[model samples]
Target: MKWITHLEGGPKRVNHAAVIVGHKIYTFGGYCTGENSREYTSMDVHVLNTITFRWMKHPISDLNYYENDDILPFKRYGHTAVVYKDKVYIWGGRNDRSSCSNLFCFNTTWHCWTATKTSGDIPLARDGHTAVVWKNYMYIFGGFEEESDSFTNAVFSLNLETMRWTYIQTTGKIHAYIID
Candidate 1:
């Protein structure tokens, strides 16, 4: 196996989120370990070219530059990302203090993150969740809540075209975990 090594490129992070669109891999926010036992989350974005094995740091642009009525995703990890159409959607990741329930979308063509405005039943703030995009819809399930010290089995669906969130009821309780 030929291992790819490019230490001088991309974020030096752990628990970060990455998604492959076409042949390029885009990576976002994660945590960094510091000396003296310290850790902090990152908010940078990077693009990696698989064919050429090169990296291009695509730092997030200024929030004010975008004309939109949405907030930016916080610097976090343990979040889930899925590529639907040309946009990469990032949802539900936690930081040091607490978890987040916000949803953000990054347009591959535009190369920007848009804090998505969602309606209906938004899922609870969580981490360690799994997400998959299927037929213009994103399905999310199972994560953890640090505040309550609990695990979730609830499933959620997000309509990528309409930008809506819906809760899918399921019978049973099963504690699930996804390590990175």
Candidate 2:
């Protein structure tokens, strides 16, 4: 595995929720500590040029496409991000105070963000959910909900083309234990 290091200058303490695409690493909403020591502060979208190892802040004008200006998915942590069809999708994470159920998509081609209005049954608000892209669908499983403060074993799938969501059923423990 090849590792690269770069310096980011901003809030001293920020939550980490990001993904890597090509040579560029994109980090979405995260919280940071203020000079006054308040928490739950939201941060803007930031990008890192892997080749140059430099950080660049995204334009504020483009942020609207992501969702609500300041109120949307602001400075969230424990959220998950994945790149599909060259677009990045972020969903379900905790901000400074509460957990969210919003889903946002970033289109690299347009250099803008847009909120996804999903049809069908949507997953409940959660954080720490693991999302992975398999074929044309994005599969999400296993996460903790702040409201209940409990771990969930539900599985869900998002159809990228139809913009629909559906819950998956599992029998028994759905275990994949490997014994040697």
Candidate 3:
């Protein structure tokens, strides 16, 4: 693969969640390393337009509201994202202090974030996981669980329609714990 160079104004981040919607590639929160080599999680959204090959930062709205209400998800890294319809759903990630179990959605059309309410067997707070959407469900698999202090290969699925999570049982020898 060839690297695209001179793409200025793009975010330099790691463990971020990225998804393609139309011709734009949307990237959400991750750890940003600065000139001093200090790293910190950023609550920012960057978008790359494939046609123009340019990056643009999307500003967050209602910053004041976020402080008063739980409207936005915290700055996170090692999260997983999937695009379903017009919105991108992000789940599983952590900042400096702790991991997260809440699911947040970024509306591409509206350019806003929403804390989605979910029910059923919500998986444990985790990071470094992967997610994909199939049919009407979003499947999340494997991540590092801080409470257990170990890697997990557990699989869970969230139904987009009902906003319910279900633990999926796996079969065969493919089941294995994650390793660093």
For all candidates, what are the clash counts? 0, 2, 0
Alpha-carbon deviation at 89 in model 3, angstroms: 0.3
Q: Candidate 3: list runs displaced more than 4 Å.
A: 1-5, 35-42, 61-69, 175-180
By lDDT, rank the candidates, best first.
3, 1, 2
Report the Cα lDDT for residue 146, model 1. Answer: 70
What does each candidate score in C-alpha RMSD? 4.3, 4.2, 3.6
lDDT of each: 0.79, 0.73, 0.85
- TM-scores of the candidates are 0.82, 0.77, 0.87
Q: Could you give candidate 3's per-residue lDDT for residues 88-113 as a string of tens digits?
A: 99998988788989888889999877
- In candidate 1, stretches whose alpha carbon ends up further than 4 angstroms from where it belongs are 4-7, 35-42, 61-70, 172-180
State the lDDT at 40 in candidate 2: 43
Question: Which candidate model has the greater TM-score, 1 or 3?
Answer: 3
Across 1-180, the per-residue lDDT of candidate 2 in tens digits comes to: 765664665323355567788898887765455432123433357787878877787774244423465344455767788899889988888765678777788787777666788888788888878999899898899899777779999899999889899999977856678999
Candidate 1 local accuracy as lDDT? 0.79
After superposition, candidate 2 runs with Cα above 4 Å error: 1-15, 35-43, 61-72, 174-180
TM-score of 1: 0.82
Q: Mind giving the per-residue lDDT tens digits that candidate 1 earns over 1-180?
A: 886675556667788889999999998777777622122323567888988888888756334323333556666778988999888999988877778887888899988777788998988899998999899899999899776789977799999899899999898766669999
> lDDT for model 3, on a 0 to 1 scale?
0.85
